[model samples]
Target: MGFHGIAKAVCRALTVRQDGPSLYDVCDPLLLKYQGGDPHLGKFYRTALGNPALRPLLRRTGLPALKDAERLTRLRAALTAARDDAAPDWTAIGTPVAELMDDIDVRHPQPPAAKVTARAPAMADIDRAIRVCGAHLLRSFARNGFIPTYAAFNLLGDADISGREMLMALTGLNARGYKNSTLLFALARIFIAHSPARALINPPWRGIAEPMWEPVQIRHRSAYYDAFFTEALLGFVETGLASSDQAGAARRAISDMVEFCLKTSAEEVPSHDGSTVNVITALAPGPHPRFSRFFAQIKQDLGFGIYVPDCDTTACAFSAATQAGADDPILDQPLVDFYRGYQVRAGANEPRVTVPLNDHIDYEGGVVTWIDNLNGDRPYGNDLDPTLNLDILEVSFRNLKRWKIIETPQRLQTVHRIIAFQRRLVESGAFKNPRSHIYYLPELYSAYFGRCYAAFVALPLAAQRIIDPGNVFALIRARVLGYVKDELIAHEMNPFDAALALMALAHLNAEIATFTPALHCIVQNLGEGGRRGPYKAYEWNKMKTPTRILVGGPEVTSAFALMSLALARRRMAHS
Candidate 1:
């Protein structure tokens, strides 16, 4: 049976609720329908299905399993047999996901920095720290229960502890939905080595596993990124038995993620002008129950929140250069109200344009504009003219005032100070900045100072673009996203940065699907040497170290390298 017939049966069973069909009920039938599902695929669930927790709730659809080493070997053999019956086609498949090459000519690919640079001592320290972190993160992954861990893979002698830690860190971040690490090279190796074809139909993580990151939200942006989730999404769409069912589920997952990213502004504002900032307002819950409650609690805890300008920036703007259309909206709501509010604030004679917050466009949701003179219900939106009631902004801000984070402004101040202190290291001219790019101060101080400058410069450029209050969430979310994204890009766009970015994005709102492949790439590209056995990669730092030894000081260089490792480890733990 096609997925249609099978899905219908499942849906029908659900409607009446008379003991939903068991995995055994659906598995064999679906397998038979999909053409004698591989016995290996059957065994994966046949054993697991016995568990009560997985019974009907998470059953097997008889998809093939491509997990570990031996299973993959069998799966490949099966593919060989199946392809023999049909004409084999070459030049069809693209590069393998991870390029699982055993005993292959192993060459440690260059780090992104290797492509360009004249190193100063401080930069050298930073680079060394980055590389060492990359190595350690991969090693940490081995310890975390992944198959490719150092010891499990007998990599103790071949690969160093650094490589393993980098791999593990990237993988975990990828799991959360990001590809920001330098570890992608190692991850790609895993993809080249394995396939998750069978695992797609009934994903293990289900909803959480569904879209881990926003799709095509950025376009063909990162060359190093993996489109694994995109591929998986496409697979489901194309092979789905019922266009309405499986596709519907996928859409639901997407909807949940997008909705979780947005929260309705608000309904009322208090008359602060008459008294002490009497800002008591209620904020709507977010899409995800717990997250929404947490958000609401934060708002209530804050006692006051700033009203940022609301705007939508999820759609693309037409550029004569690209010759693309004005762009379809990627957000999930109407942004008319926000735009109308903007028109009103700008002193347009009257609210000329009205847009609905309910329309299918996303709006920015952070930083409400503080209009001390604004208040009142003022018939916000009518069907004829949709517009966001600036009243909602009032309510939103009041709720935010109650947020727990803002309540502890002292903590925020402390963190800010720490970031500033770390940023001022540039003052001593520690790292040679030909363009004075590192303006903050020195060391960590310089890094964060530059980061702050980047964020400040970017804010209004993104914030000012907001046209509607409904799309406010989309804009600021994009801002927060852009901030970290640029940071990752600054670091030569490595797997490590990707992980951190993913974590930040997930915290801001919903997770998406683009992170997995990027993670797989990191796992596959891990550097080799220890027990994986003398892969013959030259020491990049060692070359510079010996040079520094004669020109500068040996003891100092040795201490620097050691410090680099220590710093890298600390960074890995934090990131």
Candidate 2:
């Protein structure tokens, strides 16, 4: 079908904003003609929701939030609403349905810092390690400021600009008072250089340039990376990391990221019987080009095509934007809009999806990875993950309390539900299960969980009570510490994992002795040529392929190592 036909079909499907969009619309005979009646309804579902691996991560019972009778009635009402409300717009734009789907395949489509004092035996050694790692990172920094050393897809090409590792190293160095150093200045300049102030194709955000991380190999700009880079730069400015010359550029880039986050958010209106219906808001990853380029080359690089709105990116964006110092209160809308919206709960309308290598598990309360339920290769973004939920909690709660924003009932309810959900994950041993959180390596997840938990507890008692009501943080803390012990007991962690564990311990303020094992792990794994040892931080399914892609390299490993040693040293001296 052509654009007109597709527009008409969408208009018909969304007869009323109250009833939500209908997947049944894809079953219409007219729509079926486009796919040659291949029973594409299920494909549409899978595409929009997720592949088989992500199917089970959603709430199983009471899905879709509409039964046959109710669905049909709503569909009919939607048709009526289309006839009444959207008819004029369709007539004016003058679009036809059959013309829209002729040749369209809709599938496969943050941080901050600070500084402190230091002191001197074990401390001296830790300081030396930090310097060593810092030098390794500095040596690996591309003249362009990109950390090309971060290997992805099992290859570390000079063209690969790994935003994740770049930001990690930048912040880690800044934490050690390297913010004003020459290396950081060069890196900050790179961020300033890549941020495009020009207008974008999709969502048409203006007034600020979006921070686009163009990984030469992937050849696409990532919204997640954009928000992440923005958040990191914001932290740099906040902590006096960015030099005076770069601070203005950093602020402008942050404004760009905030704009991108707000623009990329998708609004889902659920069908409801009550007089008031709340719209669900969440952030989606983007190639966000204009309509003409939407389907030119379908690259399924991250399993679920391109349009899935995930909690990880959402949380990152929310946290970044909340701290971005925007004058508009609307920037905080996600805080209010995300209430019980995308999370797994009773009566949730989201589609269920699963994760591989650990699929047999069953649990709920954590937020699903994807929140958007549109008809992409993965819609209804299903699946709960410990790290993703923790991310959401860290950002949402911190933002809410940081700004002292008054809580509406919906916002309040969302916070409580997320806490309860995490409690369930922790108490049920889901938090410790590698299969439960498929995105990160086991040790890496432990590190992230510990760090996020530390941040959560650092909040006021009233805020901490949200999770501490059932001693949830206590259990979570124990689980994190237990994992640290396990890593030490095995005494076999790679340098990256060792560094990650050390960072977690430092974040948790564990005793100085707890730092010994991880420090040894780092020392033992040191590369032969005076380089940091090689390690893989995490892996994910490549788009359209079954192959799992690994991402990490010596630069990234050293980055973490630097942060870990630096943090451990500082924390110990303070203690």
Q: Which candidate wins on TM-score?
A: 2
For candidate 2, the TM-score is 0.54
True-structure lDDT of candidate 2: 0.44
- lDDT string, candidate 1, 31-59, tens digits: 22344423323332232223343234234
| lDDT of model 1, residue 495 | 31
TM-scores, each model vs. reference = 0.20, 0.54
Judge candidate 2 at residue 178 and give its lDDT: 20
* Alpha carbon deviation, residue 227, candidate 2 (Å): 5.0
Error of 1 at 7 (Å): 54
Report the lDDT tens digits of candidate 2 across residue range 1-575.
Answer: 34565455334323323232233331232222333222222233343223332122111212132345554454334323322342222222111111221222111000111111132235555555555554443343323233332212311111112233222222322111121111122221222122121011011211111111113123233345455455445434443333575567556656765666655454343322222222223323343422124232323312223354455765666665666765544444454345355555554542344322233344345566654443333432244566766777777666765434334556656666666766666667666554455455446666667657766777778766654567777777777777666533244444665667787788777777767767765665555333233332322212111111333344455556665666676677677
Report how far off residue 506 is in candidate 2 (Å).
Answer: 1.8
Q: Tell how far residue 139 is off in model 2, in angstroms.
A: 9.1
